[model samples]
Each structure stands twice: as structure tokens, then as C-alpha cells.
Target: MIQKQNPENERIKRKFFAYLQGPLGRDEKTIQKHADAIAWFEKTTGHKSFKKFHIDQATKFRTQLQTATNARTGKPLTASTMDGQVRMLKTYFVWLSQQHGYKSRISHTDAEYFNLSRAERRIAHTPKRKQVASLQQCKRAFDLMPSATLIQRRDKALFACFMLTGIRDGAAASLPLSCVDLDEALIYQDARLMQTKAAKTITSYFLPVDPAYEVCFIEWVSYLQNELLFGHDDPVFPKPEIAVGENGFQVAGLSRDFYSNASKIREVVKSAFTSAGFAAFAPHSLRSTLTRWADKHYSSREAFKAFSQNLGHESVVTTVGSYCPVDEERQGELIRGE
Candidate 1:
């Protein structure tokens, strides 16, 4: 039997979401995650009222979540996934406990029941190694891509741009031609003009990956300006114009508009790598690739710090802690005092 959503619970949830957005300054994606976590708790408790939330309810919800299987995967949810959901619920209840109607019924102490065990928390926080493409591998992929047609040229350039700039795919997709300066080899990720993580205005200089990448990007920009007459405000990598023909909808050429999002840009990257007989590495992994490259090439601490800054990180620690990982071979060599 389907359970109906409680109107009172729905009203409070909406209020909480607004608080998260207005006071907490959370983005849409984060607010959605919070909503999902709250929905999960409500579903487990048969849409119980937030005003009636109790420690016992939270305890029951945790137990049920632990045993729950993902509908899509048919496998038990990972410790990290469960941990995140519980953490969100804990935060929500903590906030709820202070609200006018929920104050007497819910207490801050009650929210502790939503926390996962310490063992599960450890698993959730542990950092796993990510797959990052090497400079050589990226170059090989670029070489393998055919750039005879306009669409092909854009694809090749977009792939090269990721390696050259180490820009996040989201920022890259929304960049206008004016944001990139070929002479300076820099990208201005203006938050007001484009979508950036945390709405940060980041100035990212091109990393010293390979000159070929810079050359490819520069040529593409020149073509956009000279041949296509694309203005400074035009997207660096425009979405392809699709129109109906005898063969039905097909790509005609380039449009002077940004991609709706980074998904299509990621698709171009994945196809390039797979075509070159390499595993499909997302464009974001290029940041890690640049980090690894800097670790090898930059000998001085100052030089490395500057490189980290070029990647739009305010601190070198953020760059190394997040992107730098010791491969098995390197880890073994260090352990052996080699």
C-alpha cells in the first residue's frame, strides 16, 4: 500500500530547505541531497511528523537503512552512502530540534541516534585512489583523434583544453572565448559569467602539460574568431547545431552557444580516451594528472606552490591532499627506503 506524504512534514521540509539555501548558502545539488535524506527517513517511518521525531524512530531508521539494498544495484548500500544519508538526517534533525513546533518534542541529544557507528564512519571518510591520465596517455589520445571536420576539430581541442588548463569540466563548458587568453595561456573562470564550484572566481593559468595541447587550443580559438567570426562572448567550445535532414536529425556545424551543461563535454573526453584504447577518464581527473606531473617536475617548494595556485587552489595542502596519490610501485619503493 502507498503511504501519503504528511502535509505538516512537507511544510517543515520546505522551510528547512529554504534555510539551507538562504542561511547555509548551499547549492541546489546539496539541497537536493538533503531532501533525499529526509525523504528516506520519512519513508522508513511511514511519513512520520518531524514534530514527533524521537530517538527510537531514528534508531529504527538507522537499522533499516543498514540492511537496505539499492534499488538500482540490487546490492546493499555502501558504508559511505549509508553514512552520508545518516549524516544528512542527523544534521536535519539537529536543525529541526531548535524549530518552534519541534522544540519540545525533539532534542539535540535525540539527533545523535542518527549517527553511524565509528567503524562505518571511518570507512566513509577513507580516501580511495582515483584513476588519473598521464601526460603521455593524454597526448596519445589527442594524436589519435581525427580533426578533419569542424566538429572533429572542436572535439580534439576540448580534449586538449582539459589537459592544458586543468579546469573543472563545469567551468570549462561555460567559458566564453574572452575568458581564455591565448597569449597569456590563462583562463578566467568568472563566477558571475559562468558556473564555478562554490561560485568562486578562479584565475587558472594553463599548466605545463605539453606544448602540443596549447597549440591545438590556440588554433581552435583562432579558427573560431577568423573563420567562424565568433565574437569574444561566444563559447570557447560551442554546442553543435543539430537540424533535420533527409537522414533525420544530424549535426550541421557549430553554434555560438555554450553547452547546456558539462555532460556533453565529458562525453567528448570519454570517447577520445576510449578510441585511443585507454580507459575513459573524466575531464576532472586531469586536475589529478596535473598534480602528479607537478610532483615529478617541480623540485622547489615555491615552484610547486605556484603550480597549485595555477590550479585555482588557495592552499597547496588542498591540491596535494586531494589530487596527489602514491601509486603502489612508488609506495613500495618509499617503504623499502629506495
Candidate 2:
């Protein structure tokens, strides 16, 4: 039962999260970001009724948040961070205006004040350079990984999978052995089972990074099948288990479904990169690295289709718009090389 919430705003937030999860089709990460902003605002206002919300409350909160220093950076929060909080708040209130109990109290127009000014919005929304691991850096990191245990082998294979396929981490977590066809030399990224981005699905074949990694991919599939006894229906990257060690506390070891989440994959990635003396890169960065590689390796129509297919993107133009941004240093390198 949804308990009587807040005699104030508690009921509203739960509903908002539901809408975000359901109709919005938002990923958990996005819902969490929006939920966090609302929670902070509610806590700041001492659980005040949403019916009493006003522009003044928004202004005061914005001011307070502006002077606050980032816990990680130790500098006053900039327009960007403040802007994100404000933006989420605005959207929530706009959503609030349409809800059953709130239609009269909140106006769609009132939420407009929660917005950053035009110039501030520009600063807040500006795209920054995304860091990705280059293919060479990835290879060095993969080579450094010690495949001592089943978990270790899986971690190494996880790195190779990212470099080879450019699949998103969550989708990677949900990949099933049946979707892979080593004999056919392709992996079917079918969204019906996998948690593909925006639910887009496509088949991705191996890139030209290294022919040798092909054997590693085959071995990984074989290990899942013959040794682990995983069936075609099982996750490609199975989750490691947590059980009591000799000391009687929980210890994690290779046990079985790709992580219920992506944290384990992230942890293994950082460890491998640090071991290889390469900069730590998130799994998504592999996409950017592949895009850059395609820019140099292929030309015209072929490059477009190659990168588009690599990303599961529906259009080559969309791929270029999203990933083909040429930074100044990289631009200089390209001009100099040619």
C-alpha cells in the first residue's frame, strides 16, 4: 500500500518516480537523478506541503546551492550543477501541476521560474569532451589482466567484449550466449532480452582491432557453455557469487547472472587500467574510441556505415552528430598526418 504520505508531498514523489519508471521509460540512472533532486528539495524545506510551494522557495534554494562547494571538487558549485538541480525541480513541479491533488495549487507557468536563464542554460547544457580508451590502451589493459580464476577470466573477457562490440554496459550485463554466433562471426544485440540503449537493437560484427581477440571471444562462450554449464538462456557475463569465507563474513567469488547491476564491471575496469598504467576509462568510452578509429581507418560511405553499425545507431548522420565531434588537438593530429 502507498502509505498516507507527508500529510504533505511524500505521496507525490512516489507517484513521480512511478511515472518516471513507467511511462517515461527512463533508465534507473535517470530516475535516480530526478528523485535525488526532489528528495534534496523536500529535505531542505522540512517536508513542507507541495501546495505551499512558491517561486521564493526556489530562489532561496538556488542561492544556497550556488555558494555551496562541491564535496569532491571543494569549489563553489557552478551554474551547471545548480542548473541541473533547478531543471529537475522545474520538471517535477510541471509534472505536479498535472497530478490529481495538485492541479489547483501549482501552475504550469509557476514551474517556469525554476529554469536557469537562457545564457545559464547554455552553459549548463554545453557538451564536453567524453573520455574513451583507445584500442591500444585497451589492449595493454586487457593483456595485463591475470586470468587466474573464473571471475578473473570473465573480467578480462568483459574488457575484450567492450572493445570488440561497443555494447553498453547494462546490455553487456544482460547478454545471453545464444545471441552470440562465433561461427557466423556476429553478435545479435536483440533488445527483446538485452537492456539496449533506448531499446534499439541491431547485430554487430567484430571490428578489425585484432583477429586474435576472436579466439578469446570463442573461449569465453565455450567456458560459459561447457565448464560453467550455462545454457543458451543464461547471461553472457554471469554474476560472481557472495558466500561466507573461512572467517564467516561474506566474500565474493565467481558464482553465477551478469551483475544485477554494472558496478562490478566498472570495478574490474579501473583495476585493469591502473595495472596497465593507462588512464581509467568507463566501458562506454570504448564507443568513442571506436568512432575515432573509424574516422581514420575508413572513408566516406564505408566509415559512416561502419561506425553506425558499431554503435547500433539507426542512422550514420546521427552517429556522426553524436560521436564524430573533432576536438582541437585531435583535429590538429588529423591535419598533420594527412
Q: How big is the positional error of residue 258 in model 1, measured in Å on the Cα after superposition?
A: 1.9
State the RMSD for candidate 2.
Answer: 3.9
Candidate 1 lDDT: 0.89
lDDT tens string, model 2, 1-338?
A: 33333655766788888998899888888888998888777766666789888888887777678677988989988778889899899989999999887898889998988877789789878878777777788888888899887778888888878777778887888888888988877789889988888788878887777765666777988888888788888887887677878988553755555667777777787888988987778777778887878877778897669668868987887777677787779789999995
Residue 334, model 1: lDDT of 100
**Tens digit of lDDT per residue, candidate 1, span 151-173?**
99999999888887788899888
The deviation in Å at residue 87 for candidate 2 is: 1.6
Residue 161 lDDT in model 1?
Answer: 85
lDDT of each: 0.89, 0.80
Name model 2 segments beyond 4 Å from true: 1-5, 69-78, 99-104, 241-254, 331-338
